[model samples]
Target: MPETTRILLVEDHPLIRAGCRRLLAQRRNFDLQEADRGLAALELNKRHRPDILLLDLDLPDGNGLDLMPQLVADNAPVRIIILSMYGDSGRVSRALAKGAKGYVTKNDDPAAILTAIDKVLEGEVYLGQTVAQALALTQLQPETPGLAELGEREKAILDGLGDGKSLAEIAADLGVTYKTVANAAGLLKSKLRIRTSAALVKFAVERKSA
Candidate 1:
């Protein structure tokens, strides 16, 4: 018989947490527990010692990274899979560096999450294809500013914009049409809530500093 894979699901969103539990419970071999915050997760970690950890990036009290070391100490055998909506390379890289065995975007199908859990359980690191590609690129170019929430195209355009280059020039350099660059810039403005190019540049600079 296969061993039961125990999972400790840590997420702040009630609906998401409940949905994930319901889905995971559908698997015959899973044993699951839930925690809504980082502190709660730590308490549960110390008590239940789950076989796997499904961690969210943002918690009410703190960033999930702060709990990773404690979790690793609590149960060295526990497999941690970071479940986040952001599929950016920087966050993926940081999570893996901090001991996450797997990183899968929430946009991934439920099966992807299940597969990641299974693979990590079998002692292999799992990174979705997009994340793996981004990580590979990050490795090849370490000096470039990596983003945790921005998409690849957005990161590239944003980087170009930071150099005070014209949108047309950036478009030409990227082989994308001018409207494509404009749309990308618009999307970034909306997501970042920056009204002016100056604000956008400022935000990018601050993120780089962080």
Candidate 2:
């Protein structure tokens, strides 16, 4: 590790950013910076070359998941930890698959954030308690046929469906067009072996509650 563990915190919410700043302040060796948007994050990552990135999935300009590739392209020695409001298995899986070294939800005990930083710095992947349990449950459950083959976007759409969101609402939330979400939902029906949109929604709801 560098003499000072430089960290860039990317979050749009001011209170959350302040809380993170205070928490990280407990560590005498930490050097922290903040960014409220994806573009700013990329610029800061380029200039600061932080050792760790505490990123939020929701940003003002774009989805944090979509921004990961640009940050990774910086070729810095930064390890990313997602500090998200979402603790669902699909989001966690997608974050890790995108090269996040740690996954910590906002609802998790605040101390878990500090612990995640320590673990990632020590070269280990870290998952918050809730995230771990969610992933474990997802693995243990008998998934519907073809569910495992769904891509990240498909899984996200399914999650939105489970949350009782319409395709238009999901499109807005995901920063995509309504047609895109509709097409994905149609594809989801075929993949999950469901014949109708209403049946697909039922399956998603049941699976989410399971």
Candidate 3:
């Protein structure tokens, strides 16, 4: 590890950013910079090439998940840890799959956040306890056949649902029309043999967490 650990903290909320700044101040070796928007975060990243990136999922301009892959690709060596209020398995899975070294919910203890930062910086994958428990709980449920049958797009729609995102939000994130996203949701429901939206959501949550 570098003597001075550079960290880029990307969060839109001033109070949350301030809290993180206070927590990060505990580490004298940390060189921290903050950005309120995704674009500004990227710009700051490109200029400083921070060793660690603490990103929030919901940004005013774009979802942080959408920017995660780009940031990871741009700064190949940087350790990215998602710090978000969204603790659903779908969001956690998506962030991890996109090359994030760690996922820490905003509700996690400040000490856990610091531990995550240290562990990820030391080349280990770190997941908050609640997130880890959610993933572990999936192991107790039997696998659903519908899980194996869903196509890529179907899975994407279901994942969005599991993450508690509305059809419009999912469409915006996927860069598709609202109608297209609605149609896809309908197709997934039909394929999964689910009659109600609640049932589909249950199945999606179960599958994603599993």
User: How many Å off is the CA of 139 in candidate 3?
Assistant: 2.3
Cα RMSD to the true fold for all candidates: 11.7, 3.6, 3.1
Per-model TM against the reference: 0.67, 0.81, 0.84
Query: Which one wins on TM-score?
Result: 3
- Compared with the true structure, the alpha-carbon lDDT of candidate 3 equals 0.87
Model 2, 1-210: lDDT tens per residue? Answer: 567999999999999999999999999999999999999999999999999999999887989999998899994578999999988887787799899999999989999999999999999999999899998988898868999899989988998999799999999989999999999999999988999999999998877655
Worst 10 residues of 3 by lDDT: 138-147
- lDDT for every model? 0.81, 0.91, 0.87
* Collision pairs in model 3: none
Off by over 4 Å in 3: 160-187, 196-210
Clashes of each: 0, 0, 0
Candidate with more favorable, higher TM-score: 2 or 3 = 3
Clashing pairs in 1: none
Task: List candidate 1 stretches off by more than 4 Å.
Answer: 136-210
Q: After superposition, how far is residue 171 of candidate 2 from its true place, in Å?
A: 10
Position 121, candidate 2: lDDT: 94
